[model samples]
Target chain A: MLCGAGRDRDVLTQQLQRLGIVPVVVDAMSEPVAQEPCDLVFIDVDVGRHSPALGGGVDIPQDRPVLALIGSDVPSAVEWVIEQGACGYLVKPIRGTGILASLVIACHVFEERTTSTRTISELRHRLKARQLVCSAAIRIIDVFGIGEDEAFHVLKIGSMERRTTVEDLAAMIVSGELSVQALGSDVEARRLRV
Target chain B: MKSVVPIGILFSTQGPYGTVSRAMRDGAMLALEEVNADDRFDFRLEPHVQDPEGVPAAYLSCAQRLLREEGIKHVVGCYTSSSRKEIIPSFEKHDALLWYPSHYEGFETNDNVIYTGAAPNHHVLPLMDYVLRHVGRDIYCVGSNYVWAWENHRIVRELTQVSGGRILGERYLQVHDCDVDRIIDEILDRRPSFVLNMLIGESSYAFYRAFAEARRSHEALHDTVIGSCTLCEPELAEIGASACGGHLSSSVYFSTVETRVNQAFRDAYRRRFGERAVPCADAEASYNTVHLLARALTGTTPSEIEAVKRSLYGVAFAAPQGQVSVDSENNHSFLVPRLGVSRSDGTFDIVRESAEPVRPDPYLVWVDGTGVWASWNGRRRELTNRPRLRVIR
Candidate 1:
């Protein structure tokens, strides 16, 4: 937890200890402790804005969930916390009542966010791979003088023969690393071998 | 001279959900009269009643007119969450306070509104706990398609999942839609241990009647009971004699509670609105709201919204439901939760009740640790355990 040395930290640490979570309190001005293998990070938004390290462009690890300790509801203070990618927050004068709730919400929200982010990135990669496959198929259609389905079939055959993914073979074809004529030959060779 | 304060009363009283709203309005009116009659306070409340007729848009207009034109600062009304949400901005803009008096799916804390209703922790959580402990966990949910149903069902779904139970089926109908034969057929087909009914007003009454008819024919459905958090006395009467009994409802206030305070309340309500207008949870909350408002505005002007709100916080009233008080942090009431079984007389027989008023957790942040959050995190572990394999071979 990145917080200024004060009563808030003391209360938060005590409460966290009661919940069976060990509190590793870090000063706000210190560098982002990316080496620390922590499940969650609690950053004080009030102290975060004034920190030379956080304000001077330190990247808080996006993989771990961040929970903001918010005392003020002002837009700037809250917006800064949002920019830090806080998944949940606890209102200041850090009491024990809401700590478990905040932790639960933070973990739930963070898991959701991480899942969606992973899905989006996976979708983006698939889309790019799909475009490559399409481009490779189109190139095969032009070079081998075949229909779209037949061209895709030829690519599939070549991928199977080469023991590579269809996407990988498509990337190779699209990048002009392997000629469509060579892939057609490979397909013919495989069919003859079979 | 007693200072007169104009307070706005906004309720539908003539729409799909009119039965409950009428009772709520009467409850507020009764409290207003009591406040006016009581010599203990220095101020007398004059109620300016407006029936929004259950339309969401009308609530905004009615609330605007009350706050802007009539210059009323405090309004005791809104039974549906949609109506409350609709007019909240108007209250904020006009610097007025809305005393919402209905048990709702929580997760809101607007500065411009004082929620006298049972928050999810005060109603749904307690009810869910009771049902899971005593009854079986396999539930089929049917509700009106809205936020209240959606949020409450979400809680039920999460809680059920955490407890290693399954939701057999879930369905939703439009707010006023009463075609429940298909849902009844589905319920009969699924044969869940219990049906969680989140349908409101007419839709709810129709479902109860239709389900009762289905149960008469199908022996399997006889044990498949219907449970709801929004069920009340007036609604049971609407469902009629054939279907009214044997249903379960969780509420903060049921007219059948055996207490001296409740006995007086029921007698006065019967005398004023007659036996037809049976007091329910919403009515009791509205009664509490008005009394709290009157106490808060004893010496201060209602126009000072901040002072009135400040005074309103932590205000306690010996309400019909028991000693109800406002939580200073959330502006929601610390209400006692009760689980009741409906009888043929259109009143609930109290099955279980909290020993004291439970503090309102509007966000469910405190009470929901073992519910959605736990289930979500549990799912996370399951996801991690499943081996992520690639088609390398």
Candidate 2:
């Protein structure tokens, strides 16, 4: 994570000396290339008003992931960098210390990219949960003259009040098993509020 | 790209409270284009935007329309927390994900969402500390009577009492359509040294307009200055130059920060949508979310919903706002805070900024922290983490 440094040279040099990690300051005007013998390089793309990938600035080793520092919500730039073979992106204005933490996660994404992944249970749970939440929302909409969003909130609030997950609460709501007292009270509170 | 996830985003438009919605939308759209460009999402993740015309109900209806009629499984935007709250249960019901990109009061937590904005510690608390140290002793808290302002003021009231500030008055009105005359009269009558505004929505422009018309603009408020957690660049675009200049507001990302990171963002925005499309912290967060999601979906095609959501955990991005992380525990981004003084040109100067980014504390689980989990003015209530979790009648 390249954060809080006014100049790319200063920030790069400090991280290089302090952590003994190689540094590559990115200029937005060129294309990105990973440098050698450097475990990591923090690209400073914003200084030159250019994308790190298009900038050709970073020169980290081939095997290592090019950790590109991009804006937090610049999805277009993020996508652009990925298209140029950036392994990871660290949103700018990162906490000074958060740089270390960002490196940890970047390494994780890098490992997952090259390793075995996916589990059947994760898929099963996600599908079941989606069904339950959606069905419960439909039931709430059917029960009350409200939109799907409201129904979803009813289920969410019900789940929270009942101290359970939305899937669990949705299950109960669809089963006609969860008490209607909470939902009734919530509706009453809102009616009084508006 | 083989998998296409249709994402629906809900936000406001240029009605009154500045063009934050438009500016934010522009920023988000840029991100959407980037996210859908990946080879994995060949379906071209189409974005369905709802103006909601700044109505609370409209936000609910928009969420409903998107989820039911359009089958959108992901929601990425909402300007107001209340509007977001209104659709929380909807997202939950559909088992979809809502990545809220705004700062908010913290009193609740939920698992189906990610808050990319500042929670209490990063946003409200720091400003409170600043107001006490630099501003004054007496206070008038004003806001739209929605969840964000209502709960945000509650936290202010508590912290003010603890910090030796006198809470002279507190008032509320319906967002965007509130009767500002009455509220203005009350504030003038109270004559508090500083007005703490926690207002949002369409009427956000109206309140500032009233304050300026009453000659209570941030400039005129000398010993009686007005400070707000809201009222940033977007509000300025609505209020024009006079109502905005020197207005003290708090946020994480202000467009005027003098840094290489911000300069690049500003240049691109100017090149793409004109310099007027300067970014706030939330916009950066929204932009980063798309890139992070894209990086996560790089190797594998998310043929399954669970795969998409779970993969989002550790994806990192170098975004304009700052380097952000998806809290492995709670999934909210840890962002830094900045105090911006609005200029006449719909931009802000970084008057004050957090020494560093505060860790994402969406759950508010820090020791001696405040949340629904903590004592609020010596009371206990079950708080839920519903970002923009709205209550509907």
TM-score of chain A of each: 0.76, 0.41
Per-candidate clash tally: 0, 65
Structure candidate 1, residue pairs in collision: none
TM-score of each model's chain B: 0.93, 0.83
Question: For residues B270-376, could you state the per-residue lDDT of candidate 2 as single tens digits?
Answer: 77777456676656666766666666555544344466657777666656656666775666776766676667777775656554456765434562322321222
Indicate which candidate wins on DockQ. Answer: 1
Model 2 per-residue lDDT at B214: 74
| Residue-wise C-alpha lDDT for candidate 1, range A1-194, written one tens digit per residue | 87777656888999999989998976544566565679999887645654242142345778899998876443445566888899999976576788999999999999999999999998888787998999999988787676787777888888888998788999998888887788768556545654
* DockQ of structure 2: 0.01
User: Candidate 1: where are CA atoms >4 Å away?
Assistant: A1-194, B275-277, B369-393
lDDT of 1: 0.79
RMSD of 2: 27.9
TM-score of each: 0.67, 0.58
Best by lDDT: 1
Q: Per-residue lDDT of B251-352 in model 1, one digit per residue for the tens?
A: 889998878999999898988887666788888888888999998886667899889888877478888778888888988888877777788778876766
